[model samples]
Target: MRSFFKIQFLFLILIFISARLYSQEAENEKPFEAPYLFGSDTLIELSITTNIKELIRDTGKKSKYHQARLSYQLGDSVVSMLVQLKTRGHYRKNKNVCAFPPLRIKFDKASSSYTLFHDQDKLKIVGHCRNNNSRFQQMIFQEYLIYKAYQILTPEGFSVRLARITYKDSAKEVKNLEEYVFFIEDFEKMAKRNGKIPIYKDRIHQNNTMIYEVTRMAVFQFMVGNTDWGVPTLHNIKMIAKTPTSRPVPVPYDFDWASLVNAPYAVPNEKLDIESIHERLYRGYRRTPEELEFVFKEFRMKKESFYSLYQNSDLLTEKEIKRVINYFDEFYDIINNPKLVKRYFIDNSRQVRYK
Candidate 1:
């Protein structure tokens, strides 16, 4: 009788164990939709549908998120990825300006951060701000090119893909329109690539971190005529660090407001002396002359390589190309000059104010 009872208990335990194993297996079998993103220069074409008028109409409230279908070419066949779409950006709220509002695409975080397949990680799509004029279209492309230029400077920067996005009215209320936009790599993926983790700690990056890389990023921002970032407030920048001991790296985005892209809304900060975003002010903290010189040398070596990107980019027409080159020429003039370094860096460098 004792043996029979013991055998019965063992049997019950095995049954319970088997049931648990089956449950775990079932969960694993469920489809984990993720995009298989790869390296290619191929321009991706995607069709996205959302109720634009409704989103714009409901200004004071949270716009309802919509299910959007994003289709792209893969190998020999077309593929589709499911994304949650919503209107995004600060300037869109202003009544007088009808700039094309940006979009925020949300993906299922359970899967990969890439957007190539079924993944639903968060990504921003930059498109025309208003009127959809030819010049606005070019501004969008200029922003795209600016991102490409940053990519040439560092692997730490966001990877952007030129996308020709077609906007279809889901309610069929607005006419179907297409615009040039770009997709940014997920921040998580970018940090993982460099063996770092994204951090949101509200401390200045230069306070207790490596100086060279921080200086490099600072100079790059100055080169692009951008002063629209602050590390402490986490405005227009993302920070990543491999360890607590290492300095955080900056991942910058939102260039439509940048002086280099020079959108209509772009303006210089009131606190800065310059009236133009085109004016370069070294926002970097003051360093020793030797230290600053080292940063200059690094930039000087890569200046040619960076300029070469604009020459190679076929997206801009001959006239547009010249305009772009001339804009950068103004920046190069400052960095290329030693006297300007004293005027911009030594005299203008901030210590505790920026931090």
Candidate 2:
């Protein structure tokens, strides 16, 4: 009887060890799916120039154009990026006018700082010591200031629009800005290239029709700060624009298929039932816990698809998803406790039985 009991106990011990190992493997071998979708290899080019008169007008009173030029280049490998000046000129210096110094922006990869050069000196835009953990945040904050300056200096009717701004600041007080600039002509070019011609009926400028185009243009200006520009000054600014450029045909290779399939990056156009998952979890569904657990499991297994769904989904709330992820991390630790192994087995057994 003593030997039999020992054997039974050893079997149980083996079961527990096996369960723990399988659980760990499940967690480790799980494929990572991002909750956000990301684009790849899009090129954007921008050109910044100053017309003497527009500059003078923006400055308020008539002043001579001070031989000033401003330019910058930024884009993600996956997005089509371009910037062109529809109308940019200087505001003349007046009694009320502030003497704004010319800025030269350069990117420092080593420190990841945007050093602003003016009057032959460098001004480092460092984040408060609290933000030392995130160098990207510090650089973004500095870029935002530059965007604000751009908006203030540009003309109201200017054809060039800001596209996007991306910045980071730990202090809830600081807002990081990433701005994207676009031109009206570029839109027309895009439309033509896409073989979607604007239909004009009756009205001279098709005022209502232009509204969509104008709105898109307006949004572009806000997109500019999305990339890392080495420095925060206006000098050595390289503007890259798409400029009626030919689109390259994608060539297929056997290796490309493997890369696409095995890529750890987010997949394009993958559909996920994020709203159903969110609702089942939040609305007190009977299987809320199980559903939530499965949702995360699915996320882990299909990380790329999940990321694309999260990024592309307009129906789901970003805040809700963020909250769930944060909370789930803690919950996972509790359930995976070694002391609670028996309870975990019972719970998982019940889950499997129900399924």
Candidate 3:
């Protein structure tokens, strides 16, 4: 009787331990909830105490986030809140074009995503700056459309919210400008939506990356005629891993300098052997025929929906639409032709990802 009782007690202890571990696992694997953030046309008003020019030109300084007040009139009520701002982007900073420098905004401790301001530790805001040039403004708008295209392709991507921001210079009355700007989905939030955690490991090989995600990314990059990204450099790319042991997936961004947008300042890398941003190059590794066939079939399925996106774009002018569509047409033409795909994407595929 003593031996039987002792065995029963051990079994009960094992059951208790198993239950505790299962509870923890269930919490971690809970279904991801997505926040339906952003409006089609949200009018935002902002007031900053810092000198707008100095704050924007503070490219080298990264010590502190400048404080500011943000307010938007909701019906009859004024929703005013405290916020912090920081300068963003590298190329635009060096180009002396004050018109389009990107920025990062953070909500005050008092503010939460549920509050009128929405929840975010920091939000990536791509500004429409640079002498208030209409062309540049058009370019910014087109880039936002690109983000939308990615979203349609996969739910596991960044979503952009358009905001017409009005800035007031605290020191200089005439230094303010009302321009079209857009903010992107926060990275932490994106990971949650995908039921995964963000992986910051850079310079990882494409082979080590998720096949579906990397192939889609590579095909999409080709469609955009962009040669600016690579797996090793982590340039214009982000990765997320489902778990520590899961293979990472690639998420690409920063389309302002890509071929399809073709901003005046955008240039192709000389090492790419292309003189124009309009040139398309296959930068992804050459996979087996079976692997590439699957990817190509995916793109073929996405072709009509992809073109439809550009056709109904909200911000692109007729001419801008034509130019972008034509560029895509070139890519589709290549992918449609077996001979061309072999010569361009497969035959021309880089054997080495780094080189």
The lDDT leader among the candidates is 3
Q: For model 3, how does the per-residue alpha-carbon lDDT over 52-104 read when each residue is reduced to its tens digit?
A: 66667667646257777777666787667778878877777664655446788
Best by TM-score: 3
Give all candidate RMSDs, comma-separated. 8.3, 26.1, 8.7
Model 2 ranges with Cα > 4 A deviation: 1-187, 196-201, 204-355
> TM per model?
0.82, 0.19, 0.84
Residue pairs with clashing backbones, model 1? 35-117, 99-129, 100-129, 100-130, 107-120, 107-121, 108-120
Query: RMSD in angstroms, candidate 1?
Result: 8.3
Candidate 2, residue 218: Cα displacement in angstroms equals: 19
* Candidate 1 residue spans exceeding 4 A from truth: 1-38, 58-61, 73-77, 108-115, 118-120, 353-355
Ranked by TM-score, the better of candidates 2 and 3 is 3
lDDT of 3: 0.77
